[model samples]
Target: METSLETVALFSLKLAYEEEGLSPILRDDLVMGDYQKDVFELLVRRGDVETIQFKLNQCLGLAMDALGGAEKPLGRELRKLSADFGEVRSMEQLNQPLLALKGYLKDIL
Candidate 1:
């Protein structure tokens, strides 16, 4: 699949919102960031589980780097997401939530 940064970023933000149910205050930056759309489009084009997870991990890494690498609560959530995706790498191992996410993205386009 062709990876587009915009898709990946959007997917990451959406996953963050869905997983953590972030309040408006916490979501403002993600929603308004100039790079968000491009990054998300990149990830969507990548389209493989491992690749998507890797892109998310990279995003979290960048966030941590910008924040002086502090151990924030969001880091834990990203770790969990990484692990969950790692476990269900194959389509055969996919669970309801992941499947739902895939379906949701399909509908988005």
Candidate 2:
């Protein structure tokens, strides 16, 4: 779960910030401070699904705009996946949607 969360953050940041001829933001980059694996670990440890969803939503929302907004096909698909994330009601129910969202974001990048 932590890994998936970190992947979502990393890919979202890449979608929003990466550019040609520039160094990409790696896992240990300072920009990942708030969305790091350990942060997700802590949230998971406490069963804080709401906070986890909030954090992921933050990145996904930026990613939506980065993809050219909801009118665009990719952005529309991203919006649908993000809505799935919002439907999670428990930590146990989170894995499937999180993985789906992560996979989509990674593929698009």
Candidate 3:
């Protein structure tokens, strides 16, 4: 089985790509924090508001340890994402999607 950490990382990458389309440079920038400020802009334009919010929570939870140590703007975006989506009434509503992602991550990892 894939670990939750790996699953979340892969999902983040996939979601990022889906929102922004394929761009190696952009992907590299995202991974390196070079494009942190614009990460959500594409998602917003694509009408992926929910996925963006979900991704923010996933990234935050996955990197909480590292985020505490790194001073990257991604951390701030994640915080904003959490605030935007944190009010959802049922986390269980996301369980199915997250589970599917977990399976995919497990397979790849």
Candidate 4:
């Protein structure tokens, strides 16, 4: 079967989150960043919002794991993100996480 755009977008976000975002933070032995701003920024600009929301909802746990693996500002933020996004059932609910991720990414980067 052909891959859906939503799946492709989700995979892209997750992959970039791991490669460009989480990996750097983890490798450096520091834990005060959320990473993935670049990817998310790109996603926000180039990706469909519905797709982004779907991916976020479907793959949120992976992001959570990446962010929650530490005891720092980013980690705290991740906890907050988890709590905030856990109840997301609509695209609008994703606004906070997406914006927050962008903001954190700005600060960290």
Note each model's CA RMSD in angstroms: 8.9, 0.7, 14.5, 10.1
Among residues 3 or more apart in sequence or in different chains, the pairs in candidate 2 whose N, CA or C atoms overlap within 3 Å are none
- Best-performing candidate as measured by TM-score: 2
Q: Indicate the TM-score of model 3.
A: 0.30
Model 4, position 82, has a per-residue lDDT of: 50
Clashes of each: 22, 0, 0, 0
Write the residue-wise lDDT of candidate 3 on 34-106 in tens digits.
Answer: 2243554464446564655465565546543344422556545544444434554444343444454445333
Q: Each model's TM-score, in the order given?
A: 0.36, 0.97, 0.30, 0.38
The per-residue C-alpha lDDT of model 3 at residue 80 equals: 49
Clashing pairs in 3: none
lDDT of 4 by residue, 35-95 (tens): 2334445555664455455555444445445555437666576557555645555544566
Off by over 4 Å in 2: none
lDDT of 2 by residue, 18-102 (tens): 8879998898988889999999999999999999999988888888889999999999999998999899999999999999988
Question: How much is the lDDT of residue 48 in candidate 2?
Answer: 97
Q: Report lDDT (CA) for all predictions.
A: 0.46, 0.92, 0.45, 0.45
Off by over 4 Å in 1: 1-8, 11-47, 64-70, 92-109
Ranking by TM-score: 2, 4, 1, 3
